[model samples]
Target chain A: MRIFETPLYPYERSPDQDAAAPARHPVVVVGAGPAGLAAAVDLARRDIPVVLLDENDRVSYGSRAICFAKRALEILDRLGCGDEITGDGVTWSRGRVFFRDRRIYEFDLLAEEGHRRPAFINLQQYRLEELLVRRLRDLQSEGRPVELRGGSRVTKVEPAADSVLLTVETPEGPYRLEAEWVVACDGAGSTVRRELGLEFVGQVFEDNFLIADVTMKADFPTERWFWFDPPFNRGQSALLHKQPEGLWRIDLQLGPDVDREEEQRPENVVPRLRQMLGDDVEFELEWISVYTFQCARIDRFRHGRVLFAGDAAHQVSPFGARGANSGIQDVDNLVWKLERVLRGRSPDSLLDSYDAERVPAADENILNSTRSTDFISPKSETSRLFRDAVLNLAETQPMARPLVNSGRLSLPHVVLDSPLQSPDADGLPGRTRPGSPAVDAPVDDGWLLARLGDRFQLLAVGIDVPDDEPGLEVVGLPARRHPLLDERYLGGAPGALYLLRPDQHVAARFTDYDPERIAAALRRASAQETDDS
Target chain B: MTRLRTEPNIPDGDGFYEELLELHQGRSKEESDSINARLILLLANHIGDREVLREAMKAAADTGL
Candidate 1:
């Protein structure tokens, strides 16, 4: 069955619709896209009751936001659907850049060994949403308090003294609901954001790219192929990527002033595809869309009890596949903090760190996305001259190859200056330093990341962890067990202690076991101590 | 820190100028500009010193001012 045509979550009348007063929920998430679905799944896993609302009952129509990076896959693993999604997608680590039909350079994203997931997986965005919906179903069958209200459109959002009021419209009627915490994961055009009168702030590029997803039976290697000024589409760029189920995504850059409606017509699009793919090739167009580059985001992600995440919080040009990937990272960074605040384990002020950490991450994503867009579509003649010069020299010169920016594929933004991280007392590898996400290594029987998510973990290499400490799980590894673990974590130090946050980011590290320091860092990480002094 | 060597670094200065002009020979104005840009990039990469590049840029911009 075509999943896109099927209604995965049909609308059903809920008891809250008939209640006399607005029913209150601990957490209410709007929009069932990648970010919203992920946020709901995370809260349910932590046993925090959450309600997810979406205007549509089925997956999104087109294949939007296709590439899932390794860090996002790792987060999905914590959500319990990583392996399934990874197996069902096309995994690729190599990409080739070309100029006028001549291949110039190729790159391997994951050159090192001992990594579990590939650098990226190309799957239709609909498949990702379906998998998350299935995961939500699995959690529900296990008696988790999670409700998915499809066809329930959030119309109004009003902030109160301690709670947020939401008006949801459904086929049955409109209902009023109150939520202690509201997470808006709606897409670029977010109704929740509009109701609250919040607007995004950034630059918007004046260029349109026509994306055509075609299905054909051909032998093409699963790799990204990017071209600058190809013969088929002269004076502009083109990109080709392999997707699962015999689908190929092709993006052709159409300059600033073009009729968007006329360009997407099948008659107009078929000729463009025929010129590029040749007349002998048998293909069928699956989806066609014309998207403009926009690298804009909200100034802040959090607004009192109403918090915004995903595209509702930020939007970037689709150059580096940073849109949905960073959205999932936003969910990963937020769920744990919300859980702690709800359980009285952390103060509400702890939620403020979400703004501090994620805003910087969003800005970094925007900066990278904007730079990539500029390289791909040079606005002026001098810019194009320099871009072409670099591409020309890149054919034989290695130095010029690094200057060729074909979307510096998405990487996890390290939270370097987070208030949660305790100052490092012991020198170690910078890759696994404080404020960086935990790097995975081989443990005794499985991977190290397998044992370190959803809660605070203390990883001790050749050190005895105090077992009596509450709220901290300890995983002890013998000395020199794995060379990667030694190089990445120990870094010439015989033994060390590391504290990991619930999201698997490094919080603190020490050469010797110090309970007081660990306790203070934990307090700081949870926002229990507002002041460092 | 490396300084921009304004003194005679190339032993055959006239020969170097002749060769550089030959590099842009028979090229249009656009092509010559592109060749100059590429040559600058290559030389800047060979120097591999940002301080020297910055000083050279400042000196080049100060020409005829």
Candidate 2:
């Protein structure tokens, strides 16, 4: 059953209809959703040259950001639209946790078996912006240098002192642009962060989520259930999930002075979807919103030459779906350092290490979305008597179920002290140390993140690498005895030597085989000689 | 029971007591006693001021036992 009542994609106003000779772009990209079409399909697979603006040309009607994790589907399978969005998403790994309605435990974000990807996938933010606009129209019909437009609108942003000037405003008229970098995957009220006013600090959770998205057909169980206070809707918190074709995406929790247009009527969402999907099943509603829970960000997602990715550089509290999966992992860490500082191969203070590694990954996604919105809206009464004595000792204690935070879900953001990582050299195992991430297993039958694509390699599991340099790519694993690759790349060692990054992360890992510590961790992961190894 | 200035209002108090000892670092002592009973019920629900939370739980049980 197809339902995507959100369509609008038509452009060609000859580069801002010949914006009276403003031209000076190397990348402009502002809000084309899903972190500006996954940073214009990872900078047109590095043939760089983007423009991508968007004020409205549809593609975001509802079912907004439906859990995409798995490192944002391996940065959308390295921006080539991961197998057409894992064949239009729906994968799952359980997730139940209820309290006011029993069933207290069931998780399996739990994955194993030589990974390839599948820790999440619910698909729909208008099908992840129509599969990143069909991979930016297949990199604009292979003539690369993306250009996407769509009713373009930006009404100002100047940030100069080197370059960044824009004015746009189209549907036929007004224009003037320039860039040498200016990305703000505009969302979360970011008209280029309000045309460069900036200062977006944090916290706002006062509670008030509605979020509907129905279509129903019962026989549930696609997982992720979460309840808290639910006797078929009473004292707050609900959330359910399924999305993909015959949809389902609940979300209740309407407190803190509601009446915002009578709980977004459909007669207040059909008696709370007939007291939580039951009462002779059969549903309808397809999109709704009430929202209210901000966890702000942007103290710095790089300024000068402007750069900020996804929900305009940080915003959370969509419990663990970490708002567009941390804005598509902030366009996979600012499109490989804005393609090595736009091909000058690094320098431009390597964009201050993408605001020194994404302001501690946006303060760890605004402190896990403000501790899952204070453990699902427990603003007082001693945080709901310690979140109901830790969900009544998590129903029967499995050691209080990882302190039950229904949304401590999204992971992957471990730049363990990153200045582009290079320390770890001792006997391995802090689970792929050196600003972590880059673990997926199974090799020689494919998968170790499909040969760590998106380049910048040096891998080596049972060890023996360091040979393909000239833009280094080397991989050599042989000595395999998989078990999640000797526990995520040899910890009880037989050999190891990672180095990675081109957005796979882990820029350092050695147990032996030190070609000068993998050339000083590939020159401290491409910012070049930072005095360390 | 309202004498609660909550001694040392955080702010780098030795890096917030080394991230509150890295939040019971790597838990497990019954998950660090259910993470100190869910971090003293999330700091008694952020000190929702019940007589300043029974005077900071009787000065944290009479100054650390």
Candidate 3:
């Protein structure tokens, strides 16, 4: 019989006029990890409605990442959570490396000056998550609530010409969510990235390492310690970091042939740690797991309406503490742009810059972390020999110190090719240009791109505003405070001005800060309106 | 106790000496002296407070190296 199947339900129109309107949220964030949470908080603070969904019921347990760089702390400060985090976290001003019982090398993170904060701080991942969750909840209490749905697993994401449709399942039932933008922060095994059919290309290390969290009563120094060839295991190495609550994190290299199940047992780890500690101290086992390093990044971070951040976009080895810090920066880069787009102040192409600026940063960080990994834990015989030779030279030669210090590592600052930055005119060295250091400049409190302002701003430094510069606000700096100026220019005063973006990245710098040039540059940077004229 | 002279070329302070220890078990006289000099400077930088910086510099300068 040719019977037409009954439609699921007759479409009923609501009496309300808005019922017929298409569903369009300002922003939709997939995954509730640090990256997604940070994005949601920033957007919500800007009075933008955000739908943040995660598959897990609560923050994931186990110490995923513990170290945060100085820049990351600056970001947290802007988000209004830095004080709490810094107060709770341990600041390691120094670290030491050992070869068996003898001390080999040491690093001082507090080498540079004018750092608004310390170089690095160590805090457990769970504590960070707790702080973020509390802050998000507090924001919700203030009326500008971020819509966070836990256990609402997203199964399918289809990007439309103007928006994105996400099919999510929850305990109540299945529902469809439509968003003007979608951010996928679901982590390394990201379903959103896979469904989008993006390629995550890079290298995966062959060697596996065991990470053990232990409760210890030992009297070891509070500093982070690395042992190259400690007693018991030659060639193989170990990393010991002190965590809060009298806990310690130990990373030990496991041979390829070692049995994962056997080595993971508490019995195996306890003895190994004891061997390293000698007969002087006592400790108890807490948690043990094996992790393999991978240096991979998505070729394209954003595809149409779907955007990726954190481990979903890129991942690096944990050598230089770049993995989590970079992910947080990704959120910092995107949140402001997403806010502008949602507010209809800018076009979607604004999202493209996120990819342009961050992808290169990710690649550079990966390369750096890989270099550190290879040097500390050489994979090949040739690399091992080379490292040994370099160390030997550094021992005898006074000039070889910076090379070794550089090898240890530092996080990189972002430099962009936007229109806001002034072009390099005179061949001056080590000067603060667009995307360069703001070390010597006099930073103001509400001066947009001033010192420790964690948001992007347009700095019209050292410029006299002509009558025509109305929409743009300009701040003038004298030559004495602004060291980047050429001595010959502006009668010895630094005539150059810089336009800093919200993320502290310089979009453009100008030698003159001419009203017409500065306004045009700001327009180009905000991507607000194309400069056809 | 033997003293080492500060050299102009080296950048980091005694931290380099500590790092050198990681690479080589020990070094020659020249290496030890230079590393000590670098360490003193690095520590001076770390004590960024002007008073602290000066104190560290004075201590290093006065030490028999």
Among these predictions, the greatest DockQ belongs to: 1
lDDT of each: 0.90, 0.79, 0.68
| Candidate 1: residue A223 lDDT (0-100) | 82
List, in the given order, the native-contact fraction of each candidate: 0.50, 0.28, 0.00
lDDT of 1 by residue, A97-153 (tens): 989979899987764676677778898899999999999999999999999999999
For candidate 2, write residues A1-533 as lDDT tens digits. 24354445765576545656788888888888888888888888888988888878768776578878788888788777788887788987787877886877787766756678877778887887887888788788989988878777889888777678898888777688888898888888888887788877787777788888888766677887888888877778798898788788998888888887888889878887787766888888976889786888878888788888777777888888888887788778778888888888877776788788878887888888798788888887657767877897777766667778878768888886767777788877787888777878877687877777776887877766648555678777765556777777776778887878888888887777757667766876778775542
Native-to-model Cα distance after best TM-score fit, residue A56 in candidate 3, in Å: 1.4
Q: Write the per-residue lDDT of candidate 3 for residues A228-324, one digit (tens) a residue.
A: 6567566777888887778788888775667888889987778788888777788887778887878899998988888899999998887777877
Per TM-score, what order, best first? 1, 3, 2
Best by lDDT: 1
Worst 10 residues of 2 chain A by lDDT: A1-10
Shift of residue B1 alpha carbon in model 3, Å: 51
lDDT agreement of model 2 with the native: 0.79
lDDT (Cα, tens digit) per residue for candidate 1, span B1-65: 54888888887999999998898889999999898888888988998899999999888889975
Chain B TM-scores, listed for every candidate in order, come to 0.89, 0.34, 0.43
Return whichever of 1 and 2 wins on TM-score: 1
Task: Score residue A485 of candidate 2 by CA lDDT.
Answer: 73
Interface RMSD of 2: 8.2
